[model samples]
Target chain A: MESDQYYLMRTLKVDLGERSYPIFIGQGLLDQGLMAPYIKGKQVLIVTNETIAPLYLERLISSLPNSLTVDHVVLPDGEQYKNIDQINTIFDALLEKRHNRTTTLVALGGGVIGDMTGFAAACYQRGVDFIQVPTTLLSQVDSSVGGKTGVNHPKGKNMIGAFHQPQCVVIDTDVLNTLAERELSAGMAEVIKYGLIYDEAFLCYLEDHIDGLMGLQPDLLEQAIYRSCEVKAEVVAQDEREAGIRAWLNLGHTFGHAIEAEQGYGAWLHGEAVGAGTMMAADLSCRLGWISESDVKRVESILAAANLPIYPPEQMTSVQFKEHMAVDKKVLDGSIRLVLLKEIGKATVTADFPVELFEQTLSAGDKLGKFI
Target chain B: MESDQYYLMRTLKVDLGERSYPIFIGQGLLDQGLMAPYIKGKQVLIVTNETIAPLYLERLISSLPNSLTVDHVVLPDGEQYKNIDQINTIFDALLEKRHNRTTTLVALGGGVIGDMTGFAAACYQRGVDFIQVPTTLLSQVDSSVGGKTGVNHPKGKNMIGAFHQPQCVVIDTDVLNTLAERELSAGMAEVIKYGLIYDEAFLCYLEDHIDGLMGLQPDLLEQAIYRSCEVKAEVVAQDEREAGIRAWLNLGHTFGHAIEAEQGYGAWLHGEAVGAGTMMAADLSCRLGWISESDVKRVESILAAANLPIYPPEQMTSVQFKEHMAVDKKVLDGSIRLVLLKEIGKATVTADFPVELFEQTLSAGDKLGKFI
Candidate 1:
């Protein structure tokens, strides 16, 4: 075991003061026995989806100490299935199994699994402890790091939720080998977002190595995920409850969430909606003279090269977008505040932007899909 | 107005450092226009029960600034209605009214209304501000002061909740004038608990003034409410999350919750269960030699004078008590940790008590209801 191997398995902290925890990212990190210290009690409930349970659940359980009592609840996969019904199922299992407050809930899947499981942990016994075992590229970079845990309501995305941080986040990069290629690219959208929101240099690196990242070149993927987590962790540390700069992370999410809610949650992958939504935000920012038109093109090029959407579903009209975003959780008072890029690296949450430009951005896109 | 009149309307602070807020206990605090400053937004959603809305809702609304947009949701009154479904109803109203993150939720009833409304505010847009306007004696003394907010699941009482502090708590002493006799007695149970858990002198005061409190003498009742809030505020200030000394607050809750869950919530008022539950705990303490049998008798005498139950329901046997309590949220790992009195003024949370002694205590109680 060399020092570089240990360096490759990097530990990043989401510094939320007393509630802070570390994120362990690298290949075969689960098998390296990293999860045991975070497991505070005798009982561990591994909450995973049906899709990932067979592939990685056993490997996770095998890594834990043999003396630990473990049970699992396999939820049906996909974002469409993430709802209060599934949460009820998790609660029912905990009660039936008699898992007490001391039980640690381990979420093993993608963002849906992590969000729902985190919420279940937050609500159970007024809250118990939970650990995130993110398996998807998107979750590894975004959802698994922030303390935002929730399920979408029919009226809006993440309408019912809580800000419950996890005990630790374990990112096993090896698991990405099993993810579908389309899902892989969808995740790159969030990866690209980290650069778009805060790191111009990282954006340049993505542009330079887009091909390698798309191909799942381990080194490139690791760098992208690590840098993305670092950016997210920094923003979250400043504003754990989104009182200020933290909302910058939702650069494309306001428009993206509207698309997901209108199309139904699963029709478009979260990152796909985000990719198209990011393009809209860029166009709006360009119209506002916050960024040059070329910068918008550069964003489109990166997302396009990564095989992501640059437009929402053609069926959604600007009226629908406005209505959906109106009820968005981020809407303070009655105005929908948006995160708009001032340049490649800087983003701002503001309500000062023109409404017509937003409408133009929403109306500008046509139906199209790309694959890496 | 005399100094005594001013004393009747005392404002006590729950010192939680930055999250600290005042608990206003007085006859006409609501009409004094105290709630306006605490309400942060133009919109206020007053969540009250059908039973309470007609009694005091209009008075509350009239006290708010006329420029503010005010709405009320009248839920059917009962502990049974405090669940996720009701939470959804609150959500629906918020959405339908297009209440944004800036909207404030006002809980305008007793514990059930306060807990459910506070939870609604907590889950709405991740969280919104809420104020506690406790109308019952129980709420004025206990639940309204603490930030513990959640709906109940069929499996347990308050099984699904969060620790969301309210902006402020307004206790209109006059509202107790409309409370039913049983409800007032139930509130007295909590009032007595304050003395039992942390203040022996307060317990002695309670013993001396049981007649005045039960008779609803204005000065005596105001004094009791003020002191109970003080004890609760101190406990919560030290341990807001029930990590240690705060567990003492659950002195009767573990056993009380089981009774509420088994009998079905609302079949017995929460304080009614606590009344009997506290006696059971006191008896257990007596058997353990932590407190004398005479001390236990004194506890019984105080509760009896306040018109509360001192034993479990006739239908509930020791086995049922064991089974229901096994699933209590406070059961860490597999052990049921109980908050027991070392003496009337001192309480400790421990799993060290003998199991058979607990069972014997459960079986020792007779089915008798007491009235002042």
Candidate 2:
């Protein structure tokens, strides 16, 4: 059984020259003795939140080398708590424990825990090595694979952050079995995004496997995650700093961020925001003649099947959308540059889209269910 | 005329591949139309402190392209204020004004302001372009050269920071004419450090031209700043993250940081602490038989001539020194690594030095004046 577990392990590389690292995918990876080599020092500081700590913290501790000294900082679980205040807690634990530059921080939770832990590692002692043990499907498929580490700002989501990559990413599909159904659906949104932006067949596969993914089938989930990681890895390797093609990764993020920011961060899971936001993007793309109306219906149907939101929140208005998006990092000079789909598996980052079409989509986005 | 300032400009390059940037040193770079090309967008946020805004901020503003929209966030002036609180003030200004990723933040002040601004830029929008308009001798010669940007933590100096390089460094030496004599002396400590670590010839130049530098002779001051930047640039280019040889730059900083942390930041100017700390490092080096006692004395004399401190504070005990040094970023695992001089112009980073010798130096460090 042990040998079979090890045999199931697959690795994907994110080629960032000297800073490149690997993402390991499998079941039972947390128990397979995989974390020791990546941890270079004698000291380890695992940062997880209250919810995740009770689930996998003990299991993670048992897997580490016995001789290594270990400590943990348990943060409050939620997106609202992901801020500079929480980061200070990690810094306090490290300094109080006298953990030095050689210390390795393990981010062992979902996107919130991983982001805060990765950021803490990035800032602690001017940067220490860290490994990602993503527990949520959202983090495994999206946040954990990218080097984008940051905390949310009141005005925007992920407004304050850094581009510090982890030493390695350890993705164990078994952890997703315990994830909340809402969280599981949220993760599928990003998984579907990879296919929408880069791989058409992958999108079709996700459409077919939505039920299997929702049930947390190990093989189906692992394949989906592996494919999603491959897509992000290719984009990040080409533009480590998000100078050009990397901006494509922000496909639904412009609308998603506005939703998360306006409704308060934790009220809506990041993926729920992205799911609805992607539908809005598709609608805008169709209006621009890049994607057809039928294509938009197909995108909406897939997201609906995954039980993800396919429309903007009722309270959100066109003015509010524009107001929130104006503060986005994607806004260059005074113009908001958006990532819109050209067709299935194709996207373009542009500021040339018509304002009338965008305004029309914003006014009509929440009513897309009637057309579907 | 005005052309002389442009003609006299000296540009030094920090070659870190794609992150490489130039440092321009001259008399009136602010007024010489040097910063416009580097400003990527119409929005420019100039982060200056209270002490510097009245003096050079106006000149910098006038020099910027008129079409550019520029705003200023002047923080309180002091090392004590160089924390997350002040960094938040920059973030507040940027978010309130809706400054996006394309915005360029110009850090115009002493080392404290430059460090905070660079850090703010590093965190704002996950990293934005920042230009260093270093006005202090300490900043122009040292802090502004490498990509080292951060605020100080109460437990340790520079405990919280990121290795975010500036887009360009603009050093206007003319501003130093208004700098206090005390500040000038603080700047010399770093200037003397370059000679101690990398170039014996430069040490001789500083020793011979001490009067010209003290008097703020534009050419002499500019030459010293240029050479110091060159040495720092070379070291940083090879080790941008301070994983190895770059630690040599901390020759005086380890001891200096302990002093600053114990006394509280801003109580002792960073260079003053560094000056006294260098004497301690020299004493420890002599105890290790790495440098002769006379060489230690020579190092002290140069610092004394620059009107800088040559002894650790009297209030600090050897135990207190150890306590603070224990929390330093350089304390790898449990071992305290010190950068020791091999000779007047050579240094090495090692943990092999005798603890008894280090203790002896710490106990007798403040009493070195009697020996000299």
Candidate 3:
């Protein structure tokens, strides 16, 4: 049965013209030889975190062809460790090993690992090839597919980074078997985001399968990941640089980044913050009369079903959100532009929204879905 | 008379399609309102070093349209200060001042400041618009025109960086008056390189006008800078990513980088090392029967006339050169590729040359131009 699941593997391409690459989704992709073709050089450096090294490092290494020389650098896990110092460690390893410009970096962990490795490849010798082997649900569904690679700043999230795409993304659904329940919930938030922003049918599907996905039902999980990546790939292809429609991907990210920044990164897993931030966006959408209060409740219920947060942390104030959001990459000319839903599956990035209502949303706290 | 010199301004475009930008060369371009059109935003962060801030920062500020908000960060000068910490200082200033995505960073110094600032602009907020206002002669003719921006690592020169083009480059020849003589000589090395690598006519032009250029005579200086930039702009336009002909621009860079890395960055200015490295390359080319011994002497003579070094530093050994060259960005699959001359005005990037001749050239030292 497990072998049959391998035969059911799916592949998608991110059409970035010359920079285009494929994303492979399946069970046990690590051992399936999917990675061999995308690697452009004879040398490989696998960048993973300490938490993930013991789990799959050897499996990933043994899967590569014997002709290639491979090395690994295990970074400390967590968002706080994502900084320039850690990036230097990757550089140090590459230099110490004498990895040349043709070396390919394989990111072998979750989003943090993918981000740091992709960024290191982006700037290593002023750019090299990198492959994404995203092990966690959050990374597989969102971060891995897009070329958004960066580390966090003490004051902001992803403040320093580059738009460097990976040569290919290897997503093995079986890796989710080891993911913590909280992380599983976190990944669901982005999965749900695709539904909210681009597909009402996907949202409906998630609503129907939320429980099975939470329980790690492989088929349900694969469907959710495949659809989410499809939406992400479509959006990224249309607006790779985020000059237009790509901003839609940040549906709740502006508010979510503020929450993550306020409480400190890693205090709230990115998706949890997005879970609540999406509710806040939906609430504001309700206020704008673009969506009904019931629609806001629907967003709350879907997120709640996924075991994600539906409200900002009680300790965070509107002033803190304002402070953090002002520094967001999305902000332009000092005005904090946000992605708000015009309908259940439609969104717009706008700064034309009323200031008073935004201020009210910031202070709304637990009463987000109530139209009072 | 000064106003007439301003009318002699030359404008060239780096034709990179969407990433295309212009290079403006002349005397006192800062005061001519050449910068206003290139700045994409209302906020400007002028990043200059202490040395340049005193000389041209205020003048640069006064030249900007008063409607724009301008800020400045003065970093300590020299190549040693070019690293991640200094890049953070630029980030700190931008975030502290609340500069948004629309803010444009202005790099207003020589290679070190321009490199760090352009890199900061490349990574800050995951990339932003920047304008290059190169002050030193070397930068105006070379670094400022190309989109190659980075800072050196302890293990290597420019080990970490990005390929980020600027909105435009504003070169003011008058700034060279305050430039130290050694720095002017260093700039001449690259000027001579334009002659050696791409144009025999330009090489002969430098041969004839070497004294006037060294003395910083305005007309000769302008012509040298113009022709040098024209070659650089042409090469960069053909190979923006350095995957092809762009590597030809590194004529002396492999051996030069080895010298720079061994002596520690800033011990020998980059062009000084290149001056000697180019001599070594010419020697090896002679050994390859690609060029005659007299041709190597011409290289030595032109470099000597510019007050640049024609030999590697005394303490550097062949082994150290081998060690450092092994880590060069040009090295592919562990083989150190060098840009060697085919003739007086042509160069090729190759790892196919004889190893013995390369070793002999490394140990040649003061005997670089002598045939045996």
Candidate 4:
């Protein structure tokens, strides 16, 4: 789907040759009057959930030209339903109605629906076309932009899927009206991720306007999504297939996926699980003497105020966590490569830490009560 | 996953950046002894069907490094089982065993299993390492090498999947010993496809040794497979995503997928369906004033001798056929592009043809009575 996307200027990119596209950021992209040329297709599949579908489905569909036949598939809202069974519901609906390859599937919800819908499109007749209309701040910044799509397995989340790119990404800041206070707070964790891993300047901006973001201020939310996507897009362009630098994107995900799988999907929001995982990552780095206590606390302080968990899941045993660690994508030659803090805004991937100490930190940290 | 691959001379590249690898095709590739160097991880998921596992799995597995954990998931034999729900069985098994992202999936059967298993790997955690071990002539020649992996939907065959590349492809010509005569004949259709579309020399070879191939002549099968892989691998290298030229591979699939979807899966092997579809394509070319009378008959005569069908199922009405066409991948702007033969060794993809007359020829040419 060769789309001429007008994304915020960024350093990273998702280079898949003819399929390569940029994730545009900045306000009012739907009103920019530039994306109409790339958006073509007599029929469109605007896939969302009951929660986000009714709120923004009309605006997103109206943004398209009247020549298009926009169809919608609203799913149940939550990460728990992001499984193969749930994804098949989409397949059943598409096939029953006779959806074809050229038909576009626009994912219009949080991380759960976006990932599941994108994966469905990837597998529909070896793949069709799709777009992303992320409503939640978490999706606007992270899940909704990347081509990585899949559903959770009983053993693991995102255990089944493919790398299918979206034709275009339409992020309407106005959709944030439906987002709960807890949802907004949870999404802030990923916003902090971009700064911790890529842009230090963006981190400082969050620190300054942390109050406005906590309240779901439209201007602040848009800026964060734009910057986060810019950083993500740049990284993706250079490493479309996650062979090298793209591994950096999994900074806290290895620990996060483990916690998500262990605690069960929807028990804690993805952002919250990731928030806790990020805290564990900073602690591990401190134990390994990679970063000082101040930087770790700075990371912890941000997550704590955002109402995100700052410790690992208390229900998980060290052995359970260890078993989960073995499945991480970053591990090579049976060794786990961790993306840990070298400073407040810098991180490095390393496998030199003591295994016993790492496990000890994970166990001890989880023993602590939930974030205050 | 980059290995020292020795094809004739070219670099069989997969455009998925660092995840890409060359597909080796030559005599005695199994003994050339390059698998241990390329295949990573100690644990492997060797997926094959009951028909193929007994013939050559021992030889191929023994040749590999002993340090590997090669567990096998044997499926029942047939194209009927290559569906979305069936493919999920593989994922459930992999996840139930706690198989991680680093685990390699070895597809050890023909196109049905290769497509299903490769697709399973593709969706398993958004993708895992996969190696294609094609046993049937059809798979060895085509499906085993290319990165296309998916399962069939009830509405259509291969209606769900992704463009996932295998870590490496292992084609052991020794497994054709157990292939049924009907299957061997069905496989020749694809073998002939490479020649009709790209390599005329290979087509001449098939014409020269029809009986020899039917008798399971080792040298002839190897020559056919090697040549077809060479042509297919070359095409894959040029257009990995099937954007333009790679799509030329689906010469008869536009009609074939519909027939298979209409008649149910196992009732017609994929190759048998393609064989019939190819005949219809030749006739369509004749109707369009593109191919000679004998050229159309030549395709029909040889396919008939090989015990393959030259017509589709008779029960399908024009409307039913058109309804099936709704899900074909070639449809764009709400029109299905039919790939018809311009001559014996040439084909063209166009949507400008008349549909009413085409349906009449298809309905008049039903040959399901022979198989059903």
What are the lDDT scores of the predictions, listed in order?
0.87, 0.88, 0.89, 0.75
lDDT, candidate 4, equals 0.75
**For model 1, what is the C-alpha lDDT against the true structure?**
0.87
Clashes of each: 0, 0, 0, 20
Residue-level lDDT tens digits of model 1 in B143-190: 998799998888877888998999999888888888999999999998
Name the weakest run of 10 consecutive residues (lDDT summed) in model 2 chain B: B363-372
**C-alpha positional error of residue A39 in candidate 3 after TM-score superposition, expressed in Å:** 1.1
- lDDT value, residue A17 of candidate 1: 81
Candidate 3's displacement at residue B310, Å, is 0.8
TM-score of 4: 0.89
- Note each model's CA RMSD in angstroms: 3.1, 1.9, 2.0, 4.6
**Tens-digit lDDT string for candidate 3 (A223-262):** 8899999999999999998898899999889999999998
Give lDDT tens digits, candidate 2, residues B1-372. 255443578999889999999999988777787878888888999999889899988988988888988999988999889888898888889999888888899999988888889888888888999999888899999889888889877666788988888989988888998999999999999999999988999999999999889999999988999999999999988888788889999989999988888888888999999999999898888888888988988898899999998988887888989999988888887889999899999889999987888888888864545432
- For each candidate in turn, the TM-score is 0.95, 0.97, 0.97, 0.89
Task: For candidate 2, give the lDDT of residue B350.
Answer: 91
Model 4: how far residue A286 lies from native, Å = 2.1
**TM-score of predicted structure 1:** 0.95
Maximum-DockQ candidate: 3
lDDT of 1 at B161: 90
Error of 4 at A68 (Å): 0.5
Residue B250 in candidate 2, Cα distance off native in Å? 1.3
Give a tens-digit lDDT track for model 3, residues B1-372.
235543668888889999999888887677777889888789999999989888888888988998999999999999999998999999889888888778899999999888888999898878999999999998988889888899888888999999999999988888899999999999999999999999999999889988888887888888888899989989988888888899999999999998898888889999999999898999899999999989988998899998998889877778989988888888888788999999989999899988989888877773444433
